[model samples]
Target: MQVWLDSLLALLSLPQYGLTTLFVVAFVSATLLPMGSEPALFGLLKLNPEMFWPAVLVATAGNTLGGALSWWMGYGAHKMADKYAHSSHHLRALAWLERMGPKACLLSWLPLVGDPLCAVAGWLRLSFWPCVLYMAIGKFGRYVVMTVALLYIWPDS
Candidate 1:
């Protein structure tokens, strides 16, 4: 079992799979999933430093698509909000999301709740283009800063 798992991990870590994995992982990470895409981006960069810009762009595009999906989900979740009102968490989040408007989507780069924040923005019917633009900026900025910082701080890793 361990050998099989190791082989699968090795296959995923290969250069041929690197870019596509980065994009898909980044996209899924931006969704409601608990996964993190940073390690994938960093691994790809460490393996092929020449593809830095392309990798970042691909990651940015994937993350943006995920954010767009989140928005659509929120747009479709109108009927479920009532059922969730028993939890003050959802209520407060919805209220805050409504009040902050599209500008709040800028923080969608954060961990844990950030992914849902994008969906909530969509739920509130915030400006579409602006929300997309903000998500791209934040997600791209994260890829740039976090990946670069990780490389610099943990060169041996």
Candidate 2:
């Protein structure tokens, strides 16, 4: 497993593959999958500090697109969610989401709940463009802050 991981990392670290690898990882991590893109971002930046901005931008774009995909998924799953609509917990959560509207997508950068929040917004049929805009803004901020913090903490690397 360690050898395979090292080989994969080596392939991704190549000059031609670095940004693309980061984008793919960031996109997938934004889904319901239990993975984090931070390590990939940090590793790429550590190896090529000059590519920081590009990496962040690519990651942000990929993550935002992934969030959008989740939104569509939620939109399509609305019927399935309907069965639980009358539950107390579901009602309260729905009320909160309805009150917040598309603005709730700003919280889409949060861990665990972030990606699902996008899906909920879609399930509730909130305005798509606005949610996407908020998602992009939040995700961009997260990538920038996280990457900067990580770089600061491991400057020698």
Candidate 3:
């Protein structure tokens, strides 16, 4: 097990597979897990400057997919919590979500609240396709902005 784990880590660290690694990192980071994909993205771009746009796009795709997964999880959780659907807090939260609508997903790129926002969007049963579309746009913008800033600040040194 230790050997396999080490090998997997080594493979993920390889610059030759940087984009794939970036995708995985971005996906996992977008989940409820406590992780960040920015470092992985920055490292990959530093090693392979030619793949800037591709890397950003891949990261955006992966992260957006992860957000969708979170949305599904929230949907599932909501289903399981049907018993509490009538609670005051639950009703209040649901009302707030209804007010926000799918546009709330535009904030899905934010760090802390981002992932949970996706889940909440799902929990509220907001329109899935619109939420996903907003998530993709936000995630793509985030990747592009962060990658560009990192490249500018660090250069190719």
Candidate that scores best on lDDT = 2
Residue 145 in candidate 3, Cα distance off native in Å: 1.1
lDDT of each: 0.85, 0.91, 0.87
Q: Could you tell me every candidate's TM-score relative to the true structure?
A: 0.86, 0.92, 0.82
User: What is candidate 3's TM-score against the reference?
Assistant: 0.82
lDDT of 1 by residue, 1-157 (tens): 9999978767776768877898899889888989988888887888788888888898999998999889888878856776777788877877887777887888989998789989888777888888999999989998889878877776886
Q: Give the winner by TM-score.
A: 2
Off by over 4 Å in 1: 1-16, 85-92
Q: Say which prediction, candidate 1 or candidate 2, comes out ahead on TM-score.
A: 2
Backbone clashes per model, in order? 0, 0, 0
lDDT of 3 by residue, 43-72 (tens): 777767788888888899999999999999
lDDT of 2 by residue, 13-77 (tens): 87589999999999999888888888889999888889999999999999999999999999999
- Model 3, residue 54: distance off in Å is 0.3
